[model samples]
Target: MHTCLAFFIIGFLVSTTNGFYSSSDDVIELDSSNFDRLVMQSSDLWFVEFYAPWCGHCQNLAPEWKRVATALKGSVKIGAVDADTHKSLGQQYGISGFPTIKIFGSNKRSPTNYQGGRTADAIVEQALSQLRTIANERLGKRTGGSSGGSSSSGSGEKDTIELTDSNFDSIVIDSEDMWLVEFMAPWCGHCKNLAPEWARAATELKGKVKLGVVDATVHTQLAQRYGVQGFPTIKFFPSGRKDGQAEEYDGGRTSSDIVAWALDKFQANVPAPDVLEITNQAILDDNCAEKQLCIISFLPNILDCQSACRNEHLTMLKNFAENYKRNRWGWLWVEAFRQQKLEDSVGIGGFGYPAQVAINARKGKYVVLKGAFSQMGISSFLKELSAGRLTSPLVPLNGVAEGKLPTIIDSEPWDGQDGTLDIVEDIDLSDINLDDDDSDKMKKVINYRCPKFFQNNFTLSMQSLSVYARLFARAISSTEAEHILFNGLLRLSSSSVHATQSSNSLAITYPSTAIKHAVHLVTVSSGYSSHDNNEYECITKTKRRNSLIEQKPHPSNVYGDDAFFITKHRLGDFLGVADGVGGWREHGIDPSLFSRSLMDACKSLIDNKLIDLNPLTLKELLSKGYKQLLEDKQCIIGSSTACIVALHNEERILHTANLGDSGFVVIRKNTIVHRSQEQQHYFNSPFQLAIHPTIKDPRLIADSPDLASVTSFDVEENDFIVIATDGLWDNLPDATILEEIKQIKVS
Candidate 1:
């Protein structure tokens, strides 16, 4: 018997090295012909290794796989298939890498790829853990076999469960298993789009979780129970607690997302990270690695779990844990005060009590959870990760191609002074080119500090942020992009009269060689326009952008109503327009002051490249700015409509946030592609109805205008995004605007 056993072992080694592995009876050799028969039909859990014969990694894993198969023979099913020969089988399972291991859960349809360490021990450990979960589930099912389940049994029905008001309580409520149901209206467009995906997810998660659909229109009571406001609202009913307190699932609409969320919530049973867990080197080494993102949740305030934040912290952790079965991310929690190592690793132990940080051990990078630990915030964070929106590491000067890098030099830091000019009365204008002759000269727009009393400070101390201005000028060239033109000349009267307002408040003097004060407006002229009604037709000429300033501070300056705060703010490239409501003038209020105040608020907020840049954040930024403007002395009783356009050149995202009627447009190939919709109460009464008292008659009033129309669109290389106030949009039609654009010749 000993001799025979030795011979069998030798035979197994010989066959394994060959193309076939028939020597080992414990390891089931799978093929396209027998795959479904062995895997899909089997009741036990399966650990299938898909390997290519030519791959070196496959050869190394072969012996380890044999050991794993031998160790887990009776309780678990182990199988292997030569993926290179059975291309169809590999493609079905998405086997892009060699020696890919997959864990087939209780339901063979929903399989998870093994992202743990590539070792036999790790594989065995993960397999055993899953087996235990399956065992528990099966035991519970057997004990509760008498309980009536959904009439629409999850075993055979592969798609949506047709749920009505009559049978809703009986199956979903009485059953002790999770159910994902969609409340829908028959006529809804979004519901129609979601139908196929929902059906697919039901088929994928066949026996693991139950999926149901309700005709919300026909069943008003059921709809009201779940608070289904609109069409196709998806809600997840947690196992056993179907007291009608289902969670609303709102993230991605794909079938994969639905299935993933269900699996993450149900199958993952890992505990939240604590100081004990995070400090254990073994746990960190086992969990945190290249293929997985370790999300560390640290509660700073309380050491023990008995604190008030315990429940909230654990709930947030479980939310992250749901990602385990699908994405294989590590969800860790640590008490900040308990472990200084973990705290220092993620820069924690300040401010918020329970803080979360997502660290990518592979990339040596980490991202703090800046938003709340809620579904929307976590979803946004994960979405950004999948979309490659993580902050990129700064490249060193030497790392960049020598030819593409700009010259680096050290310069003296300028003093932080408020005054930029000596006197507000006298100024030089001869050297300041206001004509087409000096269109080729480089112009600068600088934002600086100045004393409140312009006449008091003679020699103003100011720092020149010329480096940013020069870089911005070089980036925005004539050939690549152009400042969107306005229908009328912006601030033509201001240039002619210095926009004195006749108040003699103070006539400010602008430096000849240099510009001193708030913002130095320079015009780089590319070419001329001859359209009859065109105020400023901004066209891109040679590769170099050399001309045109598009901001107008005074009301008579109708050429444009834009402000370039990007240079001074050092945030991002932004162009905005604010218009003084003409009706306010009839009420004895100088509407221009409110407009200027709004623009001033915008200037201050555009400081960081990331903040105040996103569509949602841009709306919030505008709201904050508007609120601040309302409290200002000049704008207390004044009302004005604002349209701001921020350009994220790095991300190539154009975020437009407008509170009132002032809008923008995107023209492509001589056609009006995108135009911001005018939000008017009636004919021409824009938002920002009033601040003093609610006026109802002569013009319609809306204290709030539908949450400021915020829109974001990805831009093409040379797409022109034009922003202007109602002065331009109300005056010219879209077709007329496109016609004017076609008139310009691309030189």
Candidate 2:
């Protein structure tokens, strides 16, 4: 079973295979992404390796395979499939082990097993040998066409016929003799090797079988119409066959072997209702002559006409013969030992009575029906074969790249903050004075709903809301606060008493943790009539609501070289930055989409209160947002090294979720407090979410808990939280990261 199976991986460049390949090696890497255009429809021959990344043998051969590829780059298409990642290709070919190699000829649909030595020189040699054989088959056909005729006389002169385009149809397609025509090319070395043997076999078979050759190089039409890819390509034409019916001859090359093969084919008979039908000119010379596949059956023979089962079976075959006549296909049965050589050629060993197989003489390939020997079963099998459904050498390419690693998020490391920090203060009643005795004083509570698809642009200029107030803007005007709001501020609160109910500037203070207390704005509104202004002076004032700080002390001090880290954020936690996977760079893809998109969605989750700023909520936020991005129509293709820190003030704990190689460390009393663990795959490949089309592992997605490592612990004031991506970790060990942090803390 020579089934060439591999995923053509496009856009891949190796940094090292736990090591690197030599520069002399020139193997094309294949994956699911580009197998069709590069391998299936290819005119060149391809020898592909199905290997696993974790296999020690494959790892060992990595360098040698590269050498093989470099040696045969132009003449033979060579590549490798990572079977570990492409399990479908492996299953289709039944690859139970790694480093399995198969060769695909021009027809791709037909593949041959490669059992030669594993050395680079050996692989190259084998490929070259096959190429020479292919060339010879074509040359023999082009120059031998003029001698097309009958030859019978155990004599050598009258045996072999030189068939040409003009006489091929009359002598081979329309003759009674079983035609064994070899499509050859004169320039091919393999054709030269088989010429003497073929001539001898032609003489020995004489009248029983007509041996002929066609120079495929000169007669391109017949050669192409019959799919002649290699030199010395042999095909057989059976009697009572259609113009396009031909079977390729795949057998031993010796003259005696050729004579024996033709004898069996010439004598091979199925007891059809009519003897003349099997002996017809078309049947004897042209049947299965055009690469068309034919099915033949082997059934039990009855000595007398008294066997009831035999009679019924004969009746069934007769009916089939009648029904399939329009198909121009023949159904014949040969008694046991009558065509033993031919039967063995098609693998008829260990079979019971009434066995049938469809064989393609063009490729010398066949498929046996495993189903019932009935109309429904046989018809179904033929239908599948005709549609090319059963034979899959070429597959279509679906455009969409999926991967788990992300491009680094756009970010900068946090500069240590000093002196004062923004802190949210509970609303104080002592500062406010309400006129209880005023005749027009009004106390009211208004519930507001956030608008769907809030652009979240800093200014509420899209509609009537404040850009900074978010949904709170709906309750007030942007001109009222006039303060630029940070990202993710959804709800807003305002407390105001109108001293005069007429149009007036409403003094508003967009909430900022204590530090931004002085930031305030005022606006005059025409919604209220001037006539009502003097009725009661209105003192309208709005205050800032929630605090979301944005800052990350260090981006790559803890995680891997490609890890992304964000420390203090505007929401309930610290800032965030994602250093996306670098893998997508070779493909011209932005790996940062996963992290940037997810982080952007996280802001919405915070504003909607869809998630809290606690450790668990952060996990939910990260996982849900990331998965949602994965499902987005405008989706992210790769994964990222992500790290986000959430401070659960209520629990007085700092919650951290580290995915890939991004991580953090908490410091107290100028000493290390807590740290995160790094996750990785072979060598430096970190475990992360890859879009489905790009990767097969489900655990790498955010929806899987194991994909992200989480931690929760206590924290105190002035504690330095150092977070970083893999860039810092890969270069600086843990002790180095902590040692530097200790110095910064002490300073």
Candidate 3:
């Protein structure tokens, strides 16, 4: 048996020597001679993957690495080095694993490890993020700040200040700066919950109102002085008050609520904005050119509406201006027909008078108010605008991007008085209808033009309306048909012609519910791939990917003494591997059972949606999975090392948590760019999670789930991730593994 195993090992080594990829691939091949000249001092960002072609994880990552290189070809420099081939180069960087990725930013000497996912999208995203960081660093240096420090804009200033009894009086009580202080105990659960919210509010309110926190347990004197009796007690100190008692903070505990309450207090001290009339170009430019946003209202002409109505409208504007004083936004009003060009550009025509629009002059974009012109409606609109919920369409602000508003014809402002009507001295009594009833006049007009002009248009409109009504009814029954028809109607309504041939064409060409059902059946029968077949498409791609890389099932999901799981979920795709510690076998424990159970528990959590993807983290999954095993009815006695990688669906981010020797690597263009670091207390004993009924045995080593190393990065399409145990890693050399799979063509 020993001689047969020796022969098998020899055969494996001889097959993997030639490696998996070639120089013709998209990945730029780097070696000892070219590494320094091309990458070390270059201005462009470099993401280099050190890979051994023989590594199964490296082979798996080959396709994704090619994709990443192609996607970031022009923006970033993507390269690969065969660490197995170039022994000297690999040793310089301490490349001990199958694949390792390093990002050479502005500081090339200390290149950071790329911790993102193996997929192309995730890699590209993280590469871009790193690029941005490097750019921001250079920008800071040019603007008189140190590298990685705050720019001249002072964005790096800490928003939250820590206060002790010694400094609390000088910073909050005796100073002129306004402050909101929270006194809390460390042991309190409520305090821990409020900590993040307090920090968020502080960051948002930076450079304005100060937010501070005091540890009530540690700073007893400060807590007692304020009569703090709860886990979290908040107090507010107003500006310009010294030696005065702080007011109790009775507001919602959310970050937004805290921000709103503090902003209200801040705004109380600010003067309300003046509702200036757009009488000339200077008034419009001076008020709006620099502000964050400008709120413009088009009121009826003073002569047309008279004083009472115009003053009332102006009062409403003034009230809103005062309420939003904290924003320091510009407020302006225009009379109807005074700025006809502006009205046309802002889509204010046909919408009628008393129209309102919020414009970002800098962006040259505006959103119109479609709701009522009352206070509540306006408030809701403004709130949506503040929350970035409103979608603003792009508009030309008369060369706003060029630092100028469109030319405004000089006009007189409202003179705070009603105008007298200018009556004509001469009247044409010959055209008068003094004796005619209103019905008789309407009948005359209808008789003259209604039949000839309205006959065709009215008939067409009625026919189209009926068709739409029927389509809408059909849509209620069939969602897909309804969506297509409704979109068509919206397009027709938005176009210049409402009841034209386009509407007829749409009504004629749109598929019926029966036709849609037929098409769906045909699509399913013919295996036509659409976006709706995403799961099928992914599965097909995965199968094809596996077939292309290797002829043999090397790095199988399930291996001897090791187990793994790959699951696709709504949140993202998850890949995990566990290496059953061989030490458990000495005590007659089936090590594989423990590892397999742990992986199964983790997979079940993902399948059942037990792991919420909102702000998804891999550590939470691993910790929870372990907790589940501890609570299991059949307590398995064993230990294993674990590694988990997750790809978030929406963000395309890759999150990873690793414990012990079982690890993963990301390969790009035949090179290993990123690999997980091994965790070990000593030379051979790796960190692991274990379950044992009795804890009195000192011989059994059990590590907490929290001890797992967590990392997150960006990923993209076609990236490869290889997750496996130390068995494969410990036995195979990089070149031997590469040569074994080199013949397998990725279909």
Candidate 4:
């Protein structure tokens, strides 16, 4: 037995190695015969391109296809087969075009086909979507079986269940299982789209539950019995002893939605079991209290269950539990699979694995540590729990404070309502001394700071300020003075912005004390833009506009200020960035102005004591910001992306508010501890809300436009928060920034 097992392992390794070589830099020419084996053998999802060598479009797409395939080699298996050589297979899949793409699953079932203009990214995305749908469908069926197992008739087959119109009476009504029956039309596009999912679900739940599809065109009686109003209607039959009368469930759902509904409904019918049966219930009962924060770990199996129970995550969980236990908050590890079974006995779909934590059960809030947990990851999780900030029900560890927090105001020159800036009168002539030309000075100022601010510390010595101003101007034009003030303030602010002993600091001096003390200059730049310049645009115009409009604020200026306060207040900090959309020059407004206005608005609010200091005050402030922008049309016209941060001293709270794509990332111990979710949207994005025609008010809701586009999160002391425009994010990954920030010694 041992020898056989060894031989099997060796064979598996050899096969993997062979596959690796075939997928290496040298593209292996594939034909029909090998394609099947390759697709069947891959553990990950596979995308196959069937193309004719002579087709023009196919020839044009060859290089792009190759690049995409090479890029997705490890995550997804990409293969191309010559259609001329695999004429039979191509014909089988109805491949009329020269280039056809299909996604094949691990089970070697019929592949999901794709047509039209094809690119590597497009193909990969499609394959992943299909894979997720397939996986979700399978998981749903498994969930349904254990929760609603009344329809089984001693069938052992995994994918096939015997269900006829005659037996439908006994199976659909009498049986205590949730039955999903699809009335499908053979030629219907919608039905065809749902076929693969239905079949997979049936196969997955074969013995535990029942699933059947009836061709509406062929089974007239079945259609009439269910009052089928559509060509493809699905009816769900709940499990029970209901005198064999079919319970009708409406259809017209995508396969995924259908499966999700079935699982939810089935689970709802069952009751949740007591926690004790799965493990030592007393352990959790003693440590965790209801309506309080508790970190629940998920143990899937025994191999790692023991280690997981005693792992570093557990240590942090224990510490948090001990600290917050007095608040009726605690932490405990629960086996996900075990809970799934227990919940099945009643009805709850368990989520997460290895180690998952529920912050506050009464609040229905939780966070899933999907992978192996570490000490730092656990600590980050605790901090988020303590703050009560989570964008989703699943709270992210080290999340930025959600909503708005009390803004730190140095001083207010005017009340925002009637505040007037005397641009000419306020201009300080002494602050504008220049030994260099305007252009040279602009270059020096704007180019002083690096584009990727989160990764670098901005520390400019007074002597180097002149040279730095020249560099800044050269790096960024059109708004050199603004850039100088912004970067300088950030450098100076960091020095005194200490929230905790481990917080980062920045200090700056503007030539003399009078220049620094008398005037408070705040410079804000727009986050990022999706629009590209047109052909009529001049090179210089494009360069200047793009540089100024697309520039993101230095991380030190945004999150650094928040971090400083988080440390000082003994709470987490909130920070964010916003990007503007539309043509910068064409819009007759600078994107930087929008950012500036927002920062100024926030500062003014803080200065006037208008901002609510408590944790709950965030939602209202965010609502106000959204409303103020919509009402102040002259201030902004084109769309903009925003991220906001809040810090609370008491309860050590940190929260963040966000809209559009400007992102907030949290890092702990050199790893990404949390990331905010982009607001839900379709082909178009919420980021484009500013420019969207129909969304005239552009508020969170029509009645509450002011608060429409906000999402928030919480934070921790050791957490490193990063808020950035898409420009910086496009070029760098979260992991890279985390590594850099980890190297920086916080003083």
Candidate 5:
């Protein structure tokens, strides 16, 4: 009996997999030339992996591929094509790499190419995900557009349809009624998984909707023509239209969502029920003795009011009637414009053609809605009537008497700082205290918000700056600060002024103080000027300082050429400067690179394992980093320099290295203490070793034996460290920098 059952299963598989392809336990092989025809005819989801036998990755993935194919054998059709043997077929699908998979679904014309890394598990996962989406879509269709619903089906032989780009139009568009087309690629893991679910849906919807598949690889032109940007893009097309030309509806990648959407659209196209129309007087005459709530539609012409006579409008009326039909609340509709008696009964002033509705049987009690009303809008009107606030015309409140206010005891206590107090009581007009701080006084006032202060300050500042700029006006470049101040002021107030009281006040206040302080600083400082005479002198001085600093040489005392040392202590840490590759002379290169590099490198060293008391490891790590920098591409064209130290407790260590120009110093007990001489030749001339063209060479890894000796030192805790790039070192004396650091610390 078991042997007979096995024979029966084999026979069933053989009978099902007939035609141009032959199915085995491992794979379904297709003739290269007839691949398109075979794929186009098959209804099941098809996944074909195009691979080169010689490819190592493909050979390694063969077993896993076979396992996946067997697992999805009954549900999906999996096949492999040897690209080397079928070069033309491979080229058709743009198979430039081996182990490329593509998927073909019922409504798809061509396969989509998978772009991620090729792996057996990745491919299987992708295929399964796609399949689930297609399954959900099919289930949605069978369930009458309702989500999470099931459908009854017959037990019958599974059905299949072959689809391709060439005949996709005939299968999807020109044929029967609704067609759901899935655009997919075999190489795509997503497409592969979608294949099984797509096949199941096709089988379920066999006679209802014509299903087809397109091999995206073999039909590149078709996929591109349809604007198939991504794989597993499924679209629904009504009968008698091409897939792309059909009204496009976005049914997210899920198959169930697509089916639900298709059902909804189809249902919408279904014919609506007929509407019943009656004269305006007929509605008024049939009213009850009690005040009846009526929905009166007014129109200037009978022909123009035909839309109101349609079932769509009647459906809305019927729905309203369902809730109020018992006359417990009373509901009726009248064509007020057509009937003179009804018109006189309701005071509708305009030619309300379309869907105008009014409530209340009495003329003056009605509310005229002069446009089409949606179901929700009509329902809302009915609800308002029930609430005793019928659709009455809006009346201006300008002359309305103010309502009485509660007694003072009933109300909350009046807080002095509350903004509402300003509305209740006017500000004291006689009090003018100019001596008080404006910001502090403003903060104390009622309705005084922070934003208002910012605005007030900004406005006052702009007024002052405008006067200053005109009085001390000079060339365009010199007025940069003024320009910045003006632009900043404009940015604050460009929005609608006074729209927001708090914002308006802020825009005018804070900037005013900032501008005043800036103007005062610029006016008082002798060094700052807008005149050409001072500007030229300033430029010259700056250029001279930069040149002098740029010419200074690296100290030879430091162990590694490009190294930064930071000494941490309780009082404050000492920072060392190390100028690395690239020089100040390079026009486009950043001169501050040395400063930034030293800070970053030292920060990393400190943050990592280097800050501990392991002196040997710290030194070794520092040396290794310097050597690595020399070998780096960036440092090849330039040299490096370093200065390191920190003062805390009663001890300190200061160390720095230099390659070109730049140095550092130490200040202990308020005395001038210089640790290393600036590597230079005489006063202005360059040093022999520094001037040498090979000084910046990457080959110069060892310490320079020709220069002045390298230096290092230990210092007291009270010592101050002054490390500077050439810009600061060359222009200012050591004592000056020490004093500056001390002042900065003190301040």
Candidate 6:
């Protein structure tokens, strides 16, 4: 019996030792011996799969595999390996999972994993896409589609217009379309390399902006006209401008970079949304129903405030609408009492006329404006709304929860002229005080509300008061007028107080005054949190001087191979975390050195104030930090995933930039409202900026810092932000993290 079993096992091994695939199928069966010589060294493109013979998924995918192999018979080589029989080959390629497919392009040493669908159609589509990418990379040798850079004429790049000296003015200057023109020399290698990317960008921006190219060597006149000092000189000609200097394109040369820059220009060219009056149901439906956020203001009746006052309000709204045009919010207005149902539905009357509310029409929720109605007030309100920091709950719109807008009564649009009253009786204000004493009283009121630093300078001139009266001269009651002016003064005074106190704490006298005016003008539009209130108490003279003195700060927390750093300055706190890539261990490099070096470089930037701390400048900070890492004398030779968050102290806004799998999540009221998205090229392979021994090495994955995901958010006290690496995130789910936070708070 033992002899019979041994013979049966030997027969089974002899039968299927080379794996499931055979000569009958189109699939090229591979083993440990021929992997390097056949696929690695081959010049042709290859799609290879490492599979286990006993795997059910491999068996299920066998038919589709054969179909894919048949489809790309000559174009791409399809092959398979049995990992169960050849463990060395599987270990060599780091194939931990069964039926893993990899695409071998020009860089066979670092083959990319195939992430397309399992079906033959999806595989073929992805295979062709890869082939096109490889072809585009080798486009330097090709002579078609503007790649040659020898003439203005080209095939295959229809979207990319051919611009020469003869037609440059007629097509580029005269036309209303925004044009991005590239001036290149025929023999320039950089121009050749940028050809495919330029063509791709042109194709993507087909209907939006026109992209053109000129051979600087051929069109010497046009080149000198634009002062093309270098090859591949890029110039941007904006729409509707015939004379002004063409702006130099200093942005990245990648296709995505070009598209992003063009899109920004396109959006800037778009006119602000028309501030329409909701006169009827159709108008309301057209403006509000489909919008992400609808901003509706109920101004006082024309009789209450004449054309001058109404127009002033409308102009303010228009300016805000223009500033926030990128959000694509619908801006509409309605006269109070004209749209009684709409006003009541949004609870606008309780606040008084000239009230405003931002409604999320899709969610049937609205947030009433809590700040003043002037430029400062409205600006603050909108900023708060934009930051998602408005504390007011989104009250459900009346009847909107039932999928219906409030009933609107048909009415005529406002006429440019002021409405006349039935009783045309005139009144005189001869007894009212418009003298120095009144101005002094106003100054006293402002001084009382403002801090001691601004008390001496808090003076209200009669001319300023006269201007204010002229702007707001309306046929309204004295009580209402006083209410408006008093509210504005209080708001301005409160901001001044906050700014002075904050500046004192940081020992910044000059900047505090500027911050005060800026805060009052372009307000962050949120009240002080408990944390802010506590910080204000630290504004004593001794403490201020102490804070100004240089002192070494402690480093932030670290876990395993990850390093974190936090530093505070006059602007705000800089918090950052970097996760070292462990794969460098195989190459005899310490991964922790890379991440720690990166975090330390970032801390140095913050400490030395090498980079400006702003909500939108986090990407710049990352760029500077990454550059510092590259310029380090020690020569860090590993990769890391990074996440940095900058808190603009006074504004209470969090500016963040994340690269790779390390990320941060913002929890407001115990609910995650915002989080950083992981940047990954493929599954488990994150998008990282690397420093290899050889610069621009094809074997290493080195993404640009520009590709880091940069974003900003307004934060309040009690908002917990968890910044961590993939280790913590992969091991713990969001629910578990939140629960742990709750437990920590409870304890």
In TM-score terms, which candidate is top? Answer: 6
* Candidate 4: segments with Cα more than 4 A from true spot: 1-574, 582-584, 614-616, 688-714
lDDT of 3 by residue, 1-747 (tens): 999999999999977664555667667889999999999969888989888756656767888998888888888998988887899998997675557787777657766566557888899998886666556555532322122111111332256677888988878878878899888776775565556557667777876788887888888999889899896898998887667598898666545457766876776765788999999989888888888889999886554355887899999899999877767899999987678777866766422456788877777777787565778768877776653445344356543345555667898877888744332233222332333343333233222212221233433332232222222222132344434433433322211122122222221111112212111000000001012123454355335433433343222222124556666677766767787775554444445556767877888788885546643467888888898878862445578899887766667566789999788765444445667877765335678998874435666778999899887775443344555566434433333223322322332
TM-score versus the correct structure, for each prediction: 0.28, 0.26, 0.29, 0.28, 0.21, 0.40
Q: Candidate 6 residues 1-747, lDDT tens each?
A: 999999999998978743667799889988878988999989878899888766655766788999999999989899998887889998987786667887777767766567558899999997886677667667634434444653323442777877898999999999888989999887888887777668877878888888998988888999999899998899999988678379998655645456766887887888899999998899888888898788999887665566887999999999999998876899999887687788778865522456789988777788887655678878877876664546566789875446678899999888788765332122222333444444444443333222221222234222222212212211121344433433343223222223222211110101112123221100011111112223234234224323322442222211124556656677766667777775655454545556766776777777886446665577777788889888863456678888887767678577899998788887666667787877765335677878876433354678888999989877765565666666444433344345434432310
RMSD of each: 25.4, 29.0, 31.1, 25.8, 31.3, 24.7
Model 2 C-alpha lDDT per residue in residues 22-107, reported as the tens digit of each score = 33458777767887788888878788888876565576677788887777778888888777677887777667555778677644
lDDT values, one for every candidate: 0.53, 0.50, 0.62, 0.45, 0.42, 0.66
Cα error, residue 169 of model 5, in Å, equals 99
Where is model 2 poorest over a 10-residue stretch in terms of lDDT?
Answer: 540-549
Arranged by lDDT with the best first, the candidates are: 6, 3, 1, 2, 4, 5
Q: How far is candidate 3 from the true structure (C-alpha RMSD, Å)?
A: 31.1
Residue-wise C-alpha lDDT for candidate 5, range 172-248, written one tens digit per residue: 66665677666666677556555544555556465566445555666777778777787766666775434457555
Q: Candidate 6: misplaced stretches above 4 Å?
A: 1-146, 149-156, 401-404, 423-747
Candidate number that wins on lDDT, 4 or 6: 6
lDDT of 1 at 487: 9
Q: Indicate which candidate wins on lDDT.
A: 6
Clashes (N, CA, C under 3 Å) per candidate: 18, 108, 30, 55, 73, 0
